[model samples]
Target chain A: MIKRTISSIALALGLAVATIPALASEGEGLAPAGTNIRDQASLQRGAKLFFNYCVGCHSLKYVRYSRLASDLGLSEEEVMTNLNFTGAKFGEPVISHMPADDAKTWFGKDPPDLSLEARAKGVDFIFNYLNSFYLDPTRPVGWNNTVFPNASMPNPLWELQGLQTAVHGEAAPGQEAVVEKLQISTPGRMSPEEFRGATRDLTAFLEYAAEPAALERQSIGVWVILFLAGLTFLLYLLKHEYWKDVHESH
Target chain B: MANVFSRIGDWVNERAPNLAPTYRKHMTEYFAPKNFNLWYYFGSLALLVLVNQIVTGIFLTMNYKTSALEAFNSVEYIMRDVEWGWLIRYMHSTGASLFFVVVFLHMFRGIMYGSFKRPRELVWILGMLIFLVLMAEAFMGYVLPWGNMSFWGAKVIISLFGTIPYIGGSLVEWIMGDFLPADATLNRFFALHVIALPLVLLLLVVLHLAALHEVGSNNPDGVDVKHGPKGNKWNPEKPIDAIPFHPYYTVKDLVGVGFFLTIAAFIIFFAPTFGGWFLEHDNFTPANNLVTPSHIKPSWYFTPFYAILRMIPSFFGTAIWGVIGMFGAILLLALLPWIDKGEVRSVRYRGLGFRIALGVLVFSFLALGLVGAGVTAEVIPEWFPGADVTTWENAFGRLMVLGYFGFFVFVWVYTRFGFEKTKPVPERVTMHD
Candidate 1:
C-alpha cells in the first residue's frame, strides 16, 4: 500500500510539473499574442505606439517613466523628450493628460487604466481586441469589438490599422448575427502584416507594463536556482557523512 | 576565545538555568526514531515556511495599505517602486500557497505512520488547531490585497456565516462590521491576519512540538522505540533504535531545507502566479463592488471543502445544511485519532479492510479537490459532448463526498469488529534503503 501510494503521488506531481508551461500559454480561442518582454526593440516600439495613440485617454498609472527608460534601454532624456507627453516628472507614473470627467463625457464611461489590463485579461485578449475592432453604426461609439462585444470606446489606433467591417454569420430565427470574421474595408498607414507586427509590439509593451519585475525575475531566477542547487549538494554530503554512525551501529 | 564564550554562557545559564536544559531536551538529547523516511521532511519544512511567511509578512505590512481604496495600488507600489519589494511580495504570496502544500503532506504523513495514535493524540489535536488557524490566516491574508477576487472571495466566505439558524444575517454583518466587505472588513482582517492569528498559531506550534517530544517521535515501523532494546552511544536509558536530533536530524533537515528552497525560488522567480493558481488573473484588477468577477472561486487550498459546500443541496429553504456539511468534513478529519479503533499502528501489519478504506479516502479526497477547483466542470463537457455539466458534476461530486465521509464509518466498523487479520509484530524498528 505504501509503495503504491508513493508512486501514485509521484505520478500526480510529475503531471502537475508538466502542465506549468502549457498553462502559461492558455488563452480563450484567440490568436496568441506571442509577445516577448525580453525583446527590447519591440518593447521600445510598443512604448512609442502607446504614448502616441493610447495615452490620450488611457493611462499606465503603475508604470514609471524612469522604469520605462531603464527597462526598455532608453535614457531619461530620451523618455522625457519622446514619451512624456503629459509633462510629468521623470519619476512619476505614466498618467494621461485627459481628465476623468472629460473622458466620461466623451466615451459615456471613463476609460480604465491599462496598467494591469494585460494581466487581468491576457496579452492575447489585448492583441485580439485591438485587431477585432470594426465600424458599426448601431453603437454609441462608431466602432465595435467582436472580442468584447460592445466596448464603450472607439478604436484609438483606427487610423494606423484602417477601417474594418464585420462579416456576419447566418442568424437563427430570433438571434442576432454573430461576427464570423473581420475584413479590412480600407487600408491605413500600415499593411496587414505591418499592423499585426505593430499590435504584437503594443501587446508586448503592455505585458511588460503589467509586471515590470518579469524582466528581472527571469534572469535572476537562473542564478538563484544554481546557488540553491550548490547548497543542497553540500548539505547532502554532510548528511551522508553524519549518517555513517547509524549505518555502522548494527 | 573558548574560555570567554564558556564564561558568558555560564553567566546566562546561572540567570536562566532551565533554558540550557530545555534546549538540550529538544535539540541535543531528543531521540527520534532512526528509520524515519522521506515523509519526515515536511514537519521541518513547514516550520521553514512559517518563518518565511512571518519575515516576508513583516516586510509586506511595512508598505501594505489597510484601506480598500489604496490597498491594490499599494501592492503595485511595492512591486514597482520599493527596492526588492517584488521579491518580498512574491515570497509571501508563494509562501502562503506552499505552507498549505507542506502542511497537507505533513498531516498525511501522520495518518500514514499512525503518529496520531495512543500517547501522541494531544500532539495531533494541537496540530489540527494549528491547521484551522492557518486556514483562517491564509484566507484573511488573501483578502488584504483588495483585488476584485479578494473582495468577492471575502464577501462569499463571510456570507457563509449567514446560514446560521437564528442570527445568520446579523452574524455576517457583525463579522464584516458592515453590510458588505468594505473598508471596515479590510481593516479588521489586516489586524487579525498580521497580529492575532499568528500569535495563536505560534503558541499552538510550540505546544504541538512539546507534546510530541513528551511522547517521542513515531517512525515508519510504528514500533515503540522506547519499549525496544536499551543503550545508545550517548545515553544508556534511550532506545537502541533512537538517535539524538541535534547532529543527526538537524543536519538531515538542513538538506531538506536546501532542496525545498530551490523549488520555492523557482516558483517565486519564474512563475510567481503558478499559472493563475497562486494569484488569480482577475485579482490584478482593483476591487469594484459594483462589478463581480465572471468566474469566482477561492484559492486552490480551499477548493475541496468549497466543492462540498456546493455539492450538498440546501434543504427546508435554508442553506445551513451545506454549511454544516462543509464544517463537518473538517471536523471529521480532526476526529480521526478517535475514529479508527484498530490495534495495529502500521499499514504494513494492517488488514486488507483498513488498507482499502484508506485508499478510498485518499482517492476521493483528490477527486473532490478536482471537483472543487472546477477542473471537472471544464473537462466533463469536453470529454462528453452534449452532457449536462451541472448534473454530471453534482453526481460525481456527491459520490466523492460520500466516499470521503464513508471512509471514517468504514474504518471504525471494520476495526471495532474483529474483521481485521493481524501479522507478527516486530520487536524493533526496521530500516529500508
Candidate 2:
C-alpha cells in the first residue's frame, strides 16, 4: 500500500510537470524572431523620427552628438545645426529641455530617457504602443493608452496620429466590459498608412539605438562560429592522419 | 531512375555512418529512463527560460541608463519611445520571477525524489551555487529601475552586510564602490547582472547538467542501479520510459510554459500593481533617500529569509545571523546526500521516523515563513514587549527560530541512524517489467 501510494505521488508529480508547456503556448503574443535593425537606412530614418518627435520629451544622455554624427554618416556641423537644441554643444548629449520636477508636476511621472529605450523594450511593443492611443477625458493628459492604461502623459503624437475613441460593449456573465474596437472620429496630420510608416521608422531607429552593435555583433558572430568550425574540422583530419595506422592494427 | 537515386542515397548513408560512427553509437546506446514523467521537464525548461532572460537582458542594457536622475525615466523612455521596448522589459521582468518559480519547483522535485543522494552530491552543490547566483541576479536587476523600492531595497539588503564583525562597513562600501548604494554600484551591478554573473550561471548550469547526466536521474524509488544488468538498469524497460525529448517533452514544456505566461501576462498587462506588493505603489515614485517606506520588504522570494533576519533581536547581529542562516540552508542542502543513510531508495521503504522528521522540517519552514510575513506579531499578545525584543514577537518567535534550525539538526540525526534494512523486492511486487 505504501509503495503504491509513493509511486502514485511520483506519477502525479510527473503529470503535473507535463502541464507547463501547454500553458506556455497559450497567449504567445505576436513577437516574431529576428529584427532588421542593422540597415543604415532604417537607422537614419529612426534617428530622424527620434529627433523630430521623441526628443521633445525624452533624452538620450549617454549618446554623444559626436558619436551620432560619425556613425550615421552626418557631418559634425550638420548634427550641431540640425539635431542639437538650444545651448547644446557638438560633444553634448541630447538632454531634454523639460526639468525633471516640472515633468513630474505636468505628467504626474517624469518623462524617461530614450537612450536605451529601444534596447529595453522591443521594436514591436513600441510600434503597437505608438498606435494604441485613445481619447480619455479623465486623464491629466486628456488622453489614455490601450497599451499603458492611466498613462499620465497626453498622447504627444496626437496631431500626427489623429483622435480615437474606444468602443466598449456590454460585459459577458463573468467578464468585464470589453473594448470592441477603436473608432477614429477625426483624422490627424498623417494618413493611417503614413502614421504607421512613421511609427515603424521610429521603432526601427530606437531598435538600432538600443543595440547599435547588435547588427555588427550578429554578423561577426556568424563568421566567428564558422571559423571555429573550420578549425575543428582541420584538427579532426590531423587526428585521423596520426591514428590511421593504429586503427588498422586494431 | 529510382534505382540510381537509391544507390546514391545508400552510398551517402554508408559513408556518412562510418565517418561519424560514434554519433550513431551514442544515439542508440544512450539510455534514459522510459518512465520519465512530467517532473523531468523542469531542468530543460529552466535552461530555456535562462536563455530567454540573458538575451532579453542584453538588449535592455543597451538602452538602460545607470544614473540616479535618469534611471527611472530611462526605463519609461524604453516603454514609450523605444520600439518594442515594453515587450523586452516585460519578458525580462516576468522571466526573472518565472526563473525562481521553476527553480523552486525543480528543487522541490529533488527533495521529493532524494535526487541529492550520494554520488550526486556535486550536482546538488552546483545547484546551490546556481541558486546563489540567481538571488544575486534578481537583487541587482531590482535596483536598475532606481525607484523608491529600488533605492530602499538596496539600502536594506546592503546594510545587512554591515552587521558583520569588524570591517563589515568597509566591505559594504567596497561592494558598492561608494558610501552608499549609489550610481557607482548601479553601474557596476548593471555590468555584473547583465554580463559577469550570467556567464558564471551558464557555466554552473552546464556543470550541474553534466553531473546529473553522468549519474543518470533518480526516480521516486531512491535505489542505486549501478550493479543492475547493463540493459535492465534503473527500472524495467517500458514503452512510456522512452520518448523523444523534442516532440514529447517539448510539447509538455510548451503547455507548462504557456500556462505560466498567461498568469504572468495578466499581471504584467493588466494588474501590474496587484495590491501594493507586485509593483509596490511607492516604487512608482522615484528614489528619495530621506523617506523610508512604511513596510519595506524584498520581493516575495526573499520574504521568508528576510523574515528570519527580522526575527533576530540585535541590530547588527540580526543581519549577521540572517545572512548566516540563508547561506546555511543552502549549504546544508549540499550535504543531504551524505547525511541520509536509508537502505531503500523509495520513501515507501523508509522508516516512520524518517518520514515524520521530513514532515517536521517542511512544516517548520512554512511556519517560519508565516511568522516572517507578520502573522506572529498579530497572534502574539502585545503586553510582552520584552518578548518582541528578545524573541521575534517574544516567546513564539524564539520557539519558531529554534524549530527552524532544530528541524535541520533533527533530519541529519534521523537519517544517519533511524532507518532499518529491508529485503530485496519480490518478482511479483516489481511494477516495471
Best model number under lDDT: 1
lDDT, candidate 1, residue A248?
88
Query: Where does candidate 2 chain A have its weakest 10-residue lDDT segment?
Result: A19-28
DockQ of 1: 0.62
Per-candidate iRMS values, in order, are 2.6, 16.2
| Chain A only TM-scores, each candidate in turn | 0.93, 0.80
Identify the leading candidate in terms of TM-score. 1
DockQ of each two-chain model: 0.62, 0.02
How big is the positional error of residue B288 in model 1, measured in Å on the Cα after superposition?
Answer: 1.1
Stretches off by above 4 angstroms in model 1 are A1-6, A15-26
Residue pairs with colliding backbones in model 1 are none
Give the per-residue lDDT digits (tens) of candidate 1, residues A66-138: 9999999999999999999989999999998888998888889998999999989889989999998999999
Which regions of candidate 2 fall more than 4 Å away from where they truly are? A1-250, B1-29, B225-255, B258-267, B270-277, B315-319, B370-398, B419-433
- TM-score of candidate 2 against the unseen true structure: 0.58
